[model samples]
Target chain A: MNYFSSDFKLGILGGGQLGKMLLAETRKFDIQTYVLDPSDEAPCKIACNHFVQGSLMDFETVYNFGKQVDVLTFEIELVNLEALEKLENEGKKVYPSPKTLKLIQNKGIQKEFYIQNNIPTAPFEKFESLENLKSKIQNLKLPFIWKCTEFGYDGTGVKVVRAISDLENLPNVECIAEEMIAFKNELAVIVVRNVSGEVKTYPVVEMEFHPEANQVEYVICPARIDDKIAQKAQEIALQVSKKFNHVGLLAVEMFQTQNDEILVNEVAPRPHNSGHHTIEASYTSQFENHLRATLNLPLGNCDSKVAGIMVNLVGEENFSGPVVYENIEKIMAINGVTPHIYGKKETRPFRKMGHVTIVNEDMKIARKIAEEVKNSIRVISTK
Target chain B: MNYFSSDFKLGILGGGQLGKMLLAETRKFDIQTYVLDPSDEAPCKIACNHFVQGSLMDFETVYNFGKQVDVLTFEIELVNLEALEKLENEGKKVYPSPKTLKLIQNKGIQKEFYIQNNIPTAPFEKFESLENLKSKIQNLKLPFIWKCTEFGYDGTGVKVVRAISDLENLPNVECIAEEMIAFKNELAVIVVRNVSGEVKTYPVVEMEFHPEANQVEYVICPARIDDKIAQKAQEIALQVSKKFNHVGLLAVEMFQTQNDEILVNEVAPRPHNSGHHTIEASYTSQFENHLRATLNLPLGNCDSKVAGIMVNLVGEENFSGPVVYENIEKIMAINGVTPHIYGKKETRPFRKMGHVTIVNEDMKIARKIAEEVKNSIRVISTK
Candidate 1:
């Protein structure tokens, strides 16, 4: 199809930062886009051709939006599966089909599929409810990780349980009791595929964690590891994508265990923050590649030209009003530092406000600059 | 100015392809923009916050639009300068200041500025008009290049007058006759500056010409020349920009003489076609930097992570109606090829419909892929 500068409309389900960045490429190709978001203050509220405020999980809202566009895609996975399935039955095109989302939406089912497909992952047991876990405590391992079967993300509802009291606080809902593997490093691999079955995987990246927060603080490309190990990680990621027959971008989070073994952690179906550095450092940005893949166009080069690091701008703990980026001007003086404020006017504690991308020919220098950027900028409340 | 997601407005004087691309950045930052253009079907018609249809050169139309925004900038040079000057006197900030535009709006005066600043350039003589040129032919050298003193671009109103007959078809207008110097290559250097007096230059880029049309068909990054020569070109461009006190992007087109000397050809004070490859190749795109510089924000990194080449997609000569990019899919199959189809649905011979940018670690490979893209896609009329 002639998608460029045409009357064709692409419907996007989410209107946050990922959708906002994707809109940049759509604007470049002059592709018409329609955005349906829950909030009127979405980052994509102004850039798209049409904007509708509606819940993505509402069957009528999503189905109606899908019917108007030539193609449909989403930047987030928390949407109504029934609506997407109905839209597909009605002959509307939805990338990364509803079936694929269902299989991976719950942590328990996703882990089972990996085991069935011979994909390496930390061993875990599924529970219908936290009450079931209590009844089976005598047979379970201590210091295990408990995660809700569904709707768990961004450090929410995932916790380490070393004692019986840990189970008392979690909701009595379907959950997964996962083995706490002694992994040396956290890694990620982003794979792009189309309906034609063509697939490509980006180089393995390592996530440096903050010792206290249990959150990713820095993502380093060309993971400073053995070349053979990196290859193993990429090979496994390709197998996962092939097994799932995924479309668009599938970012596989993995763990490199102490024995230099790769294990699947989780996956996000759209552009992941782990790949944000590509906007400044890669030959083709993940956001651009996501658009190309969803449209069934050929994939682009995903190699990095230099080393890159991303620093997320999460709101400070004490601030919860109108947002201001303090010391943002200081980082601009440093070479290769780029701050991308997501155009979010308000901020709450722990909410993502923006990100800073630092790239340099020398990987070491890039990482140093990234640390400085992280230290200088604060997304704090002004009121 | 709290431009991000605020009520502050920026008024643009033209809604062509350049303005369309600029509007993309403004919306990305959620800075409201108002565009003024004569054509309601302009490429920027759908993207700007407000698009007003009117003559860009009309004094009243231009002045009235300029008054609506906090600041004013333009993508096209052929606007009512008198109206802009009046707006500036009324305390409206105009980038590439009206004074700088005055020196550049006329080619004869621009050349004089170069000579006065001791900038190296090809020898040229200005004439009062084409009627007077014939009388002074005895004093001028043979086989000279003739160009209109004002409003000449894209090889328009320019010709090599090798003999008297070659000048017969020329209209009576003030023109400049320039000596055709032997040059090894054509090059360009983009220098970005802000009101804060900070300046930075992109690497010198070499433009390869199409032998038959004598037009730039591909622009190669890093110039493929000696490092010293490339640095010299950038330094010369910086000197020129400093002399003009030019704000925003100043693309200095240069000629690399056979003896490895860099000579200034002219300057364009906006996001220029010569810098388009930077969108994919540079760490920070030229459009984003243009917005930043205009806002007096800190500059961005201008280094290229990979070599890039851009091929123009001009309308086919035989087709002139609703536009279609025949075989666009074929071009997508070529690695590193990304097309930017400007939202121009109409087609006309020699009109720039869009461009394709190819980036790769190897310049040689990128150039080859660019050739495949140029050969595969045809900007034609569906009608």
Candidate 2:
């Protein structure tokens, strides 16, 4: 299909930062895009050719939006599966098909699928309800990880249980009790696949979590590790993607145990934060590759020109309202520092306002600059 | 001032492809932007926060738009100088100040300024009209390059006159007759300077023009020339920017004569086509650097990560109307090939509709792929 400057329309389900970045690639190719997002002030509102404000979880809204475009994809995974299934039956293309999403949406089912596929993962047990887990509390590991079966995002819907009393305050929901593995590091590899089944995997990236927030603070490319370990992580990620039969980008989060065993933790079937540094450092950005994958175009070169580190510009504690990026100019002075503000008009505590990417031919210099950037810039509120 | 996610407004004149590319940087920084263009269907219309449809050459329109912005810059050089001067006098920050533009808007004045500043340039004489040129034909060199003093853009308003009869059909307007120098190569260097006086120069790029159209067909970075010649070109470009006291990007085009001496051909005081390859090859793209310079932010690294060659995508002859990029997919299959389609709906013969960038660690490989891309893709109208 002649998508460039043609009548072909691509429908995107989310209009947040990922969608905004994806639109940049679409704009670059002059591909027509229609975005359906719930917010009136979505960052993607301006770049897309068409904007429809509607909840992605609503069946009718998603189905209507899908019907208008030749191909449909989502930046976020919390979309209406029924609508996607219906669209597929009606002959529309929905990447990361409903079946793939169904198998991965719930934590319980995802764990089950990983085991069935013989993928290495932490041991876990699925509970229909929190009550069932409470009734058998002593039989389970004391310091296990408890995660809700569905609707878990970011660091939410998750908790670490230490004692029986900890379970008392937890919400009653379908959940999983996972044995906590003492991993040495968290790593991720983004695998991209086109409709033709041609696949490519980005180099493994290490995620450094904030001590208090339990959220990713830095995504360092070419994760500082042995080459053998990196290769293992990539192979596992490829294995996961092939098993899922996923389309577009699939970012596999893995845990490197003390013995260097790589175990699957979770996966996000879209552009992941771990791959954001690709925009400045790689031959082809993950966002651009995602678009190419969805369009069934040949995958681009996925090699990095330099080592890159990403620093998330989350809102500071106790700051809310109109956003301000303090000391942005200071970081801009540093070589190879590129800040990407998501065009979010407002900010609250812990809200992701933007990110800064630092790249250098020397990884040490890039990391030092990343630290300087982290120390200089602050996401604050004007009011 | 907090530019990112703040209320600081950046006003840009002429929403053509340059403005569209600039908007990509603005969006990256989350800097609020207002764009003015005569056409409602301009490429910048959708990407900017607020887009005003108005002639960039109208004093009232430009002034009104300037009033609403804290800082004003332009992608096109043909904007009303009177309005910019008025805005600057009223304390509005305008990069590449009106005074600098005044010296550039007319070829006669630009040539005089270069000569007065001791800048190397081809010798030239000003003419009040074609009749005046005809009257003094005997005194002028036999084969001189005649160019209209004002409003000459791209390859238009330029002619090679070898005889008195060549002036018969020329327009009756102020013009300049320049001594034609025998040049072996056409080169360009982009110099960027921030308001704080921090200046940097991109590597020299060589332009290969179409034999007939006299328009640039490919822009090859690193110039494929001796390091000494490249250094000389960069030094001259920097000198030109400093002499003009220019802020933002100043692209200096030059002619390398048979003796290897560099002479100034002309200059564009904004992002130029010659530097478009920097978007994929350099550590910092010209558009991003232009924004940083305009905003008084510290400059980024000017080094290139890989060699890049850009092929301009012009509309095919005998085809005009709604445009289609035929075989774009076929080209995408080639490694390191990226197509950037300017969202222009209509096409005319030799009109620039887009460009393709081919990048590779090896320059020879990049050039080879560029030729393959040029042969595979066709920019033609479907209707």
Candidate 3:
């Protein structure tokens, strides 16, 4: 198909920062794009050829948006799957097909699929509701992890249960309790697959969490791990991609147990925060690779020219109004620093406002600068 | 100035490919931008905050547009100088000040300024008209270069006068005759200066022209020359930047004479095609630095992460209709090859539809793939 500067159009669901970055690639290729977003102030509002302000979960909204484009893909995974299934039945192209999304959308189902495929993972038990798990508390372990089966994003639906009282304030919804294994490090690998079955994997990245907040503070590429462990992480990620037969990017989050064994944690079937550093470090950015995979175009090389590190810029606590990126200029003065603001007009505590990427030939230097960047810039509100 | 996600607006005069690329950086930082261009179908129509379709050379149109922006800059040099001067007089920030632009808007004045600054350049004589030059044809040297004083772009309004008949078809306008000098290579260096006087220079890039068309076919960075020659070119470029006292980017095109001396050819006061490869090769892209310099923000590192080469994609001689990039998929299959297709719907002979950038750690590999890219893709018409 003649996609560049042609009548062909690619439809994207969810117009947040991911869609905004994807638009940069589309603009680079001169490919036409149409975006559907729930917010009028979405960062992608201005960059796309057409933008529809509507709910992604609305059946008619998603179906209509899909019908107008030649090929359809999404940045967020919470779209109306029924509409996608209907469109696919009517001959429209929807990448990461509805069938694949079905198996990955619910946490209980995803974990079960891993176990069925002989994938190594922490042992888990599914409960119909939180109350059902509470009734069997006498039979369960003292410390475990509880996660909601559906509609959870970021850290919203997961928690550690050290005591029975922890379940009292939890919502009475479908849940899963898994044995919490002591791990040496948290790692992630992004695997990309094209419609033609060509696949590639990015290097493993280690996630460093803030001590108090327990949120991801830095994502370091090359993982600073043994070569064998990195290979194991990538191999498992590729196996997961093949079993799901998914098209586009699949970001597999994993854990390195105390004994150095790899365990599958979870997977996000889209561009994840783990790969954001690719924009400045890798040969082809994850956003561009996703676009290429969805379009069935030839995938680009995924090697890094230099070591890279990414730091998330979340809104600080105790402020919630029009946002201000304090000390942004100071950080800009630092070498090899690039900030990507999400164009969000307001900021609430812990809300994602933007991210900064630092890249250098020396991994140690890149990490040092990343810490300086993390300390210098604060996402706050004007209040 | 809170430019990121704030009320601040940046006004750009031309909405061509340069402005389109600049918009990518502005979008990265979430800086609001307004673009003015003569064509409604301009490449930048989709990416900017507000796109105004109007003449860049119209005094009232430019003046009114400048009134709505906090700081104004231009991608093309053919803007109305009076509007910029008026805006500056009224306290609006116009980068690459109108005074600097006045010295550069005309070829005759620009050459004179170079000589007055004691910069090394080829000997040249200015004339009021072509008829006047013809009257002194007996005294002038044969086989000199004839260039119109005003309004020349690309290869237009410039010619080689090898014989008297060569001047018959020339336009009757003010012109200059330059002594032709033997040069080993054509090179360029991009110098960036901020409003606060901070300056940085990109590495020198060598231009390889097409044997038959006399147009630049490839731009190789870190020009395959001795380190001392590269340093000389950079130093000369810096001197030109200082003499111009320009803010934002100044692309200085120069020549390496057979004696190993550098001579100033001319200067462009905005993002130039010579530095397009910086998008993927340099630590900070030229577009990002241009925006930072104009905003008086600190400049980024000017070092390169990898070697880069750029090849221009021009229309084939026989095509003139809806454009089609034939064999584009074949070229995309090559590693580190990226094509930037300008959104020009129609294809005409020699029209610059786009460019392809090839980057790698090995300059030899990059140059080899650049040739494969140049041979594989053809920008032809659909007829």
Candidate 4:
């Protein structure tokens, strides 16, 4: 299709940071885009061709938004699936079809699909509710990972149960108890597939956690791991993409067990945080690749020109109001440092405000600078 | 100054493709921008925070717009200078001060400034009008270059006087006759200076011309020349920047004569086409550095991560209607090929619709693919 500077319109659901980055690509290509977001202050409001302030989960809202565009896709997955399904049934193009989303939306179903397809994963048992799992506590292990089956995002619905009392205040919702494996590292591979079945995989990235906070502090590309392990991670991610038959980007999060075996952890069927560094490091950024995949254009090369590292700029604790990126100028002075601030007016503790990417020919130098960036900048509020 | 996600406003004049690209950096940093352009369908209308439709040369329009912004800059040089001077007089920040622009806004003044500064340049004589030059044609060289002193852009006011007949239909305006020099190559260097006097220079770029059209075909970064010659070009460019005392980016176009001596050709005090490849090849893009310099922030690393080549996407001679990028997909299939389409709906002969940037580790490979891209895509119309 004549998408470049043509009359074609692309509809995007969820006008958050991901959508904001995608809009940069769309603007680069001169492709018209319409964004549907609930927040009036969404980061994407200024860049998109047309922005419709509405609920992404409301059936009518999503349906009407989808009807006005030639092709429909989404940045967030919590959209009204029925609206997309209905739109697809009526001959509208919906990438990563609603059917694929169905299998990946619910944690229990996603894990079960992996097991059914002979995909290696941590063993898990599904419970109808948290209470049901508690009733069988005597038969379960001392400590396990408890996850809600649906509507969990960004560490919200997952918990580690070290004692029975840990489950007392938990919501009585559908849940799963998975046997936790002692993993040495958490890795991610972003797999992109076009509608024509052309596929490519980005290099594996390792997520390094803070010793005290237990939160991811850095995402290092090329994973400082053995070549064999990186290959294994990429191979499993490609397998997941094929099995789901998904169109667009599929970011597969995995674990490297103590014995070096790879296990599937989860997958996000869109541009994920793991690939944010691609904006400055890779030949084609993940956001651009996702747009190409959804539009069925030829995919771009997913190779990196230099080693890259990304650090998230979350709001610091004890401050919550209008946002201020302190010491941003200092980081800007550093070599290969680029900050991307999401235009959110307010910031709460641990809330994602932005991210910084550091890239260099030398991986060691890039890592060292990333640490300096982490120490130099703080996201706080004006109070 | 709390520029990131704050109330700091940056006002930009001329909302064209350059402004559009600058908006990408502003969006990345969450800096508020206000753009003023004459066209309602300007490329930057969608990306800027506030877009005002008004003549850039209108005194009242520019003055009013400048009053609302904390810092003001321009992408195009044809702005109302008196308004900017007024703003600067009132303690407002106007980058590339109006004084520097006065020396550049006219061709004769720029050439005289070069000579006065002891900068090497071609011999030239300024005329009050074309009729006056014709009266003294007997004393001038037979085949000299004639250029209008003011209001000329993009090859519009420049011509070669191979014979007396070639000046028959020339415009009756102040002009300059320059002794043509035998040059081995055309080169450019971008120098960035902040308000606080910090300065940095990008690597010299070589502009290769088409053998037949005599128009630049490719802009190759890290010009494949002797290290000494590149250094000479960079030093000359820095000298020009220091002389101008200009804030923001100054793109100095130069010539490497047959004797290997560099001569100043011209300079642009904003983001220029020669540096577009920096967006993908450099550690920090020219757009980002221009924004940083204007904001008085520290400059970014002016180093390249990979070799880059840029090819302008101009309209075919025979097409003039709604534009269509024919075979754009074919070029996109090539590795490291990225086409940036300016959002100009209509296609006229020789109109700059967009540009394609090819980047790779190997310069030879990048040049080869740039040729493939130039041959594959045709900027035609859907008449």
Candidate 5:
């Protein structure tokens, strides 16, 4: 396609940190990029060749932005599917096609697809509304996981329904009741596929959750799990990508149950955070592979050069104003630690400000340093 | 200095490929940068927060640009020393200070500096003008190297004086007459120092020149030499950096004499081409270290993760117009091969278009792939 230093323009939706990181790969290859985001101060606003400040959810905005570029892709899934469908109809290339997104966007549909395809996943019941669920509460499982069918991200739009009172505060929205499977570890495998059907899987990564927040605090690549489990997770991720016929990065999140049975939980069809550590540790970072896949370029080697652990820097509690990374220098002093700040000037409690990647040949040392980095650096706001 | 996602603006004087690569680090850390270059289409124009189009050699332009940032550094050395000196006097921080630049800006002065510091170097005599050299040709050694005192870069302003006729076409400018020593290898070592005096040296790299053009064609990291030779080169590079009290990256180019003695050739006090492979091979890239050094942050790990080889992508002979990289896809399919296009839209003969870095665990395999990459990709132009 003559993408390098040529007239080929690659359009990216959602100019957040993922888009910012994607721009790094585009800049490395000298591929022209146009970014669309609602924020004027988006992290990607500086690196892209052109930036259109507009909503990615608005059909007209997304359509107009797509019209100016040769190829279209999105970092976030909230983009307007109708617009992308129309663009594809008109002969524009949209990776992870609208059809793939349609099947994966709704939790009810996603779980059904997994069961129909004979993929291993927790059984779930689809509910048209919270009222509908209440009417049939007597027959359903008492302690199932409730998740909204659409618009969920980063632990949002999800809840554990342990009892009747737990349903009182739930929104009356289309949702799914997923069987709560007792799991020992949450893992993710990123599968990359090019238009030519070339596919590759990155090493499995373990997601460690914050005990109270129930959110991922660290992502460790080459998860310290049995080799057999890792291989199973990779195979499952590949099956999901093949079933969807997706062309791009499909990050499949899975759970290892008490009996070591790997069950598919969900998927993010883009450069997922679980693969962020690859930037410093792997032969080919997930973001670069995503770009190469979207462009139909030959995929790169996905081997790890060293073990890597990523610690996300979320905003501190009770602090909301101009962002400041306290003790950033302290962590920089540690060997093999590289911090990537998102360039957001403001800070709100629990908001993602940046992430720090710790890499080392010794996994144990890398893990220890990751803990040190997490403890030493605080993302706070200055009034 | 609150450089991370703060108001601290790093002013870079030249917005060429070096500055573009440096901007990648600043963008990764969310550090604000202001770049100045004469061309509006410079590779760094879009990446930097602010870009000023002005001649870096003009004192007023450089002084005005320096006033806008917290600290000033130049990717290119041919900047106005008067402006930097003035800025330093007014309390602005300039790394690789004007004093150090003044000593190295002129080949005559740089050679003399080495001699006065008791450093090993080829003996040389400075001349007021080329005419002065002609008057003393009878007494001087034949087959010596002749170089202009000021503004020489990338094998330009240099010539071999084997006969009196070799001086006929030379410019009437201040020059140097250096006794040419028989050397088996041309090596380089990059030494990084922070403002607080912490220093580190990158692995030595071996440079192979184009036989006809006298320009470096390939740079192999961890030079294929005995451990003792590598240590000697690093020690000599450190001694040179200490003598200059240099801050930021000091790329010392050296010669390995036939008898295994190391001698200083020249140096560049910024991110250099020889260290370009570090971006893909080392734990800390030279660009990142340059940024850390200038910010007075602790140095990063200087160890290499894999062996790296870099091949310069120069414009194809007799081609001059819009640029195109032929068979780039063919080379990209190779494992561990990364091509960095410099975003230069036009192509002129012998002009540097970009560079490709090939990395592998085995140095022999990496070098073989580098050769394949060099032979496969052609930087040509469409008229």
Candidate 6:
């Protein structure tokens, strides 16, 4: 297709930062793009040729938007899958497919898909309701994890089942109780594949968790682990992409067990935070590669040009108004420090306001600068 | 100044490719910008916060636009100087002030300024009209070059005079008659300075000319000339910037004679086409540094990380209508090939449709890929 500077319009669902960066590539290639998102202040709002502000989860909103473009893709999941499925039936192109999102959107179904594919994962039981789990508490083991099958993300929709009293406070909803397996470390492998069967995987990355929040606090690339283990993670992630017939990027979150085995955790179908380092480290940034794959263009080199460490900027506590990047200029003076502030305008505590990438020839130095970047700039509300 | 995600509105006079690249950095930093361009289909139309369409040379249009912006700057040099001077008098910040532009805008005036400032350049004589030049041709030698004083760019309004009859057919207008120096090569030095007096110069680049057109065919970074000669070029360019008290980027085009002498040709007080290689080759892209210097922010590293070669994508001689980058994918397959298509949907012969930048660790390899890029891609008319 004559996509570059042609009449072919590439439609992107979700006018957030991911879509914003994708639009940069499209702009570079002089490709026409139409972006749909609910927020008028979305980062993609300013860069796209056509900006449609509407609900991404609304059936009519998504269906109408999908029908107008030649090829349809999305930056964020959690859109109306039924609309995409209908669009697919009507001959519209939807990348990653609504079928793929359906299987991955629900945690219980995702785990079952792993089991069916012979993918190693922790054992889990899907309950019809949280009340059913309470009635069978005597028979069920204590100190398990309860995760809502759908609408679960970050640290939400998941709770620790410690005792009988803990079950009383739990919301009565369809969920999964999984046997919390002991893992050495949380890891991730980003696998990229084009429809032409050309596939490549980034090296395994280790995610250090926050002590209190149990969420990823830091992601270190080329994870410090046995080479064999890292290789196993990459191999498994590639197999998953092949099995799912996934096109574009698939970021497979994994676990490294005490036995030195790799286990599947979950997979994100679009560009994930785990691969943010690629912007500064890789010869082709994940943003650029994603565009390449979606456009069916030749993929660029994914090898690291320099060691890059990414520090995400979340809003500070007790701050809840207009966003400000304090000390942004200070870090711009430091070598290898590049800050990207998502033009959100508003900021609430724990909200992702921006990210700073530190790249250097020395990995050690890059990490040190990343830590300094994380400390110096506070994403706070200026009221 | 709370420029990031704030009410700071930056006004840019021209929304051409340079302004588009500059907007990329402004968007990265979340600095709001208002761009005015004659074309509604300008590359920066979607990138900036607000874009006004009006003739940049219109005094009222420029003056009105400047009043709405907190600080004003420009991409193209042919803006209304009176409006800029008026804005400066009214206490608005204007980088590369009207005074600096006055000295650099017209070729005849620029050459005179160099002489007055004790800068070394080939001696030239200014003429009120071309008819007057014919009358004075007896005293002047043959084989000299004639150039229009203003509005000349990219090989237009300039011609070689081998005989007095060459002037007979030429347009009777204000022009410059320069002594054709026996120069072996054309060179350029990009110097970036701020109001704070922090100055930095990118290494001199060699401009390879087309034998027929007498136009720059390729810009080779780290000019093939000796290190001493390159250093001399940079030093002389810095001296020129210092003399102008220039803020932002000043690209000094020069000529190197067979005796290894460097002569100032002219200067451009903006992010120039010559420095486009810095986007992929330099430690900090020229666009980024221009923003820093204009804001009086600390200067960035101007050193090149890789050798870069630039090939201009001019319109094919036989095609003039809709633009088509034929065989663009073929160049994409080559390593270090990055094609930048200026968002002009139309094409015309010898018109600068766009330019491709090839960067690599080795200058020889970059030059080779540049040749491949030049051969493989044709900016033709598809209509």
Question: Mind giving the per-residue lDDT tens digits that candidate 4 earns over A83-115?
Answer: 999999999999989999999889999999999
lDDT of 1 by residue, A1-383 (tens): 87888888999999999999998889888889999999988888767889999998898999888999988999988888888899898888899898889888888989999999999999999999999989999878999989998887676768889898988879999999999989988999999997777788888898986554456788888788899989999998898888888899999999999999999988888999889888887877898889989999888778888888888888888898877778876787788887777878888877877778899999899888888899898888768
What does candidate 2's lDDT look like per residue over A1-383, in tens digits?
Answer: 87877789999999999999999999998899999999999999988999999998999999999999999999988999999999999989999788888988888999999999999999999999999999888799789999998988777788888887878877899999999889999999999999889999999999998866667899999899999999999999999999999999999999999999999999989998898999998999999999999999999989898899999999999998998888888888888999999999899888888899999999999999899999999888889
Per-residue CA lDDT of model 3 for A1-383, tens digit only, reads 99999999999999999999999999999999999999999999989999999999999999999999999999888899999999999999999898899888899999999999998899999999998998888888969989999887767788888899888888999999999979999999999999999899999999986654556789999799999999999999999999999999999999999999999999988898999999999999999999999999999998998999999998999999999999999999999999999999999888888999999899999999999999899999889
Tens digits of per-residue lDDT, candidate 6, A265-353, equal 88989988888877656656777778777777777766665667778778788899988888888888887777777788888877777
Please provide, for model 4 over B276-323, each residue's C-alpha lDDT reduced to its tens digit, 9 standing for 90 to 100: 999988988899999999999999999999999999988889899999
Identify the leading candidate in terms of DockQ: 4
Residue runs of model 3 more than 4 Å from their true location after superposition? A211-214, B211-214
- Angstrom error of the Cα, residue A254, model 2: value is 0.7
Measured on C-alpha atoms, candidate 4 has an lDDT of 0.93
lDDT by residue (tens digit), candidate 6, B67-184: 9998788998999999999999999999989999988888888999999989989888999998787778887877988999988777778888887767776778899888898998
User: Model 1: what TM-score for its first chain?
Assistant: 0.97
Better of 3 and 6 by lDDT: 3
Clashes of each: 0, 0, 0, 0, 0, 0
Tell me the tens digit of each residue's lDDT in model 3 across B1-383. 89999999999999999999999999999999999999989999999999999999999999999999999999999999999999999999999899999999899999999999999998999999999999988888988989999888766778888899999999999999998778999999999999999999999999987654556799999789889999999999999999999999999999999999999988999998899999999999999999999999999998899999999998999999999999999988899988998899998988889999999999999988998998899999999
Every model's DockQ: 0.57, 0.83, 0.89, 0.91, 0.88, 0.58
RMSD of candidate 4 to true structure, Å: 1.2
Candidate 3 chain B: minimum summed lDDT over ten consecutive residues — where?
B208-217
lDDT of 5 by residue, B267-344 (tens): 999999999999999999999999999999999999999999999998888999999999999998999999999999
TM-score, cand. 1: 0.94
List chain A TM-scores, every candidate, in order: 0.97, 0.98, 0.98, 0.98, 0.98, 0.95
Residue A298 lDDT in candidate 3 = 94
Q: Provide the TM-score for each candidate, comma-separated.
A: 0.94, 0.98, 0.99, 0.99, 0.99, 0.95
TM-score of chain B, per candidate? 0.97, 0.98, 0.98, 0.98, 0.98, 0.97
TM-score of 6: 0.95
CA error at residue A260 for candidate 3, angstroms: 0.9
Superposition error at A353 for model 2 (Å): 1.1
